[model samples]
Target: MTDLVQQAGIKLDATASSPEEAVDICGKLLVELGAITSSYADAMWEREQIFPSAIGMGFAIPHGTDESRAHVIFDQLVFVRLAKPISWADDEVTCVLGIASQGDGHVELLGNLAEMIQDEDKLAILQNSDNPEEIAQLLLGND
Candidate 1:
């Protein structure tokens, strides 16, 4: 979606035993994209401790804390599909949308994500699709 998500950022069949591990993996992707520094991942974990990111519909959006926005180089998103569902706070999450955004960019991203979650057909496709392009298209509202 939006140029923020590249095929490289769409990770499929990734494995993480815990929420922290999943968040760390997401942070690594953001760092690889040059969207954020390493500390931003830690910030995500800290934020998770205070408030879980799980938004139901089998997805969780993880992002840096407000203060950690300093580590952000730009606005970007990394989508991670886990090999197995992991318990995240009160929900079991199979997908993670990691965000590294400056200013209020993340708010818009979250809003878009909320809308996406309400689309059961798209959500179903995202849950089962292994093709990065397909997933990207769905996320971008092109499919």
Candidate 2:
């Protein structure tokens, strides 16, 4: 699971004017990590249009559509913390977790994220910590 979120995958001090821009930045990080092709980025935005990804606690997990799975090369997660909050649908979001997975991996990833965010201490680090290693540890656990 640690491999899913390398230090490079964690980006901080980012800025975005809108959800679209935020998603784009997330997609670009996944592409840079060679997790998915460019088309998958568009799919993520499409998914956002049909259903917003903002799950609360200032976080939004965006992923590509099922059809966009063809563009995925491997499972990967990109964490982006914006310098300021952006309006994501009805909620405000400062953290974006960009997911690139081809199969049930995404389900598992979502489950882990759901559970992690439930812990207020961990969620606070993910939201406020500037240290990439700390954020990665929070996401992947003490291991």
Clashes of 2: 0
- Can you write out model 1's per-residue Cα lDDT over 7-100, one digit (the tens) per residue? 8899999999999999999999999988899898789999999999998988999998999999999888889999999999989999999988
Which 10 residues in a row give candidate 2 its minimum summed lDDT? 134-143
Candidate lDDT scores, in order, read: 0.87, 0.89
RMSD of each: 1.4, 1.2
State which candidate has the highest lDDT: 2
**Residue 57, candidate 1: C-alpha displacement in angstroms:** 1.1
Task: Put down candidate 2 lDDT per residue, 38-128, tens digits, no spaces.
Answer: 9998899999999999999889999999899999998999999999999998899999999998887767667877888888877888888
